[model samples]
Target: MSALDRSAATPARVWLIWVALVVALAVPIAAAAASPLLAWRGPVYIAAGFAGIAALALQLVQPLLAGGHLPGLSAYRGRRLHRWVGALLVLAVVIHVAGLWITSPPDVVDALLFRSPTPFSNWGVIAMAAVFAVALLALLRRRLRIGPRLWRIVHMTLALVIVLGSIVHAVLIEGTMETMSKVALCALVFVATAKVVADLKGRAKRSASP
Candidate 1:
């Protein structure tokens, strides 16, 4: 194909990928909401579960934006959206935890204190801490005078922790999230994260080349 032809095709392909990602991320939340599992839960617990779901869906978006993989969005725009989405992700997490605390204070305390009997609670707590740390570091990046390389390294490392921990937390819990949709969302989260990490490594390699 000609250069122009390839260029024309690129946007279409990107949009297709974006659509797939949206569908992958949305279906699980929709299914979870419609599931019989949520019917018995109180509003507080339901809110907490949905907040967690929203956070997980946002996780998938973060990597795609960071990697500049979204269709028609410039890297600058992508990063801008990433920052906004990151803030929302933080909010969702807070809501998730706070709602749970309101409903069951002792469970929240046990999770926070690392005394929770459930393995999923441990993973959730770890992921929540990592998420908070990442947000704080990003907010203080300028004030802290962190160099670009160091910032990227630290950010990506924490990202991996958040991704893995959240996935494990979601998987281990027999909660409101429907099983198959939950699995699919978690899988896509991993894929998106891996793709971004790979893209960052490739860019670093290319920049280091002569």
Candidate 2:
């Protein structure tokens, strides 16, 4: 796409993308809600799975949504939307983990403390730490006078960590994720990581050129 064309892509398209993602993410949640049988088996697993998916999708999409061409939209407004979405994502993670804790407090504690036998638990723990780090950076971002370049690097790194960890967790949990959907999501995450690395390298190359 030409620069002008890229710049002109409609914000409506981005809105539609976000709406579609919301519906996709909601399917598992709705399923959990509608199935009393799932609750009998232990609702926490399903609830946590839905919340994690919602948070992951929001984190992935918020940046694109903010950048999309929206008529008469101020920079401040776009950033405000980003912030709000981020806050909502944090809430989703909390709900996800809290549900897990309620269902199996000891197991949750074990996972956090690195005592869980499940290999995916290691990934989950790392991802949770990365999320906490990002949250801390966001909180202290202003007071610390964080520079744009440093913030970008840290944010991108932690985002990769989140995606990797979440994918590992999903792959290890056989029952929660549908086979095809899990594979597709993991492939997308892999591509996203590669794209971010390429973008960073390209920026470095340009900066180094005369």
TM-score of model 2 (CA atoms): 0.76
Across 18-78, the per-residue lDDT of candidate 1 in tens digits comes to: 7898798879988888978777889999999899999999999999889866767766888
Scored by CA lDDT, what does every candidate get? 0.90, 0.68
- lDDT for each residue of candidate 2 in 1-210, tens digit (9 for 90 to 100): 235654565778657755756665555445435544555566567777678767655655554434433333455776677677767877887887888898889988998899998888888788878877887898999899999778878877887787788778767875555556656656655665656556665876788699
Query: Distance (Å) between predicted and true CA of 118, model 1?
Result: 0.2
Query: Which residue ranges in model 2 land beyond 4 Å of their true spot?
Result: 1-3, 6-39, 42-45, 63-78, 204-210
TM-score, per-candidate, Cα-based:
0.93, 0.76
Query: What range of 10 consecutive residues in model 2 has the weakest lDDT sum?
Result: 63-72
Q: Count the backbone clashes (under 3 Å) in each candidate.
A: 0, 0
TM-score of model 1 (CA atoms)? 0.93
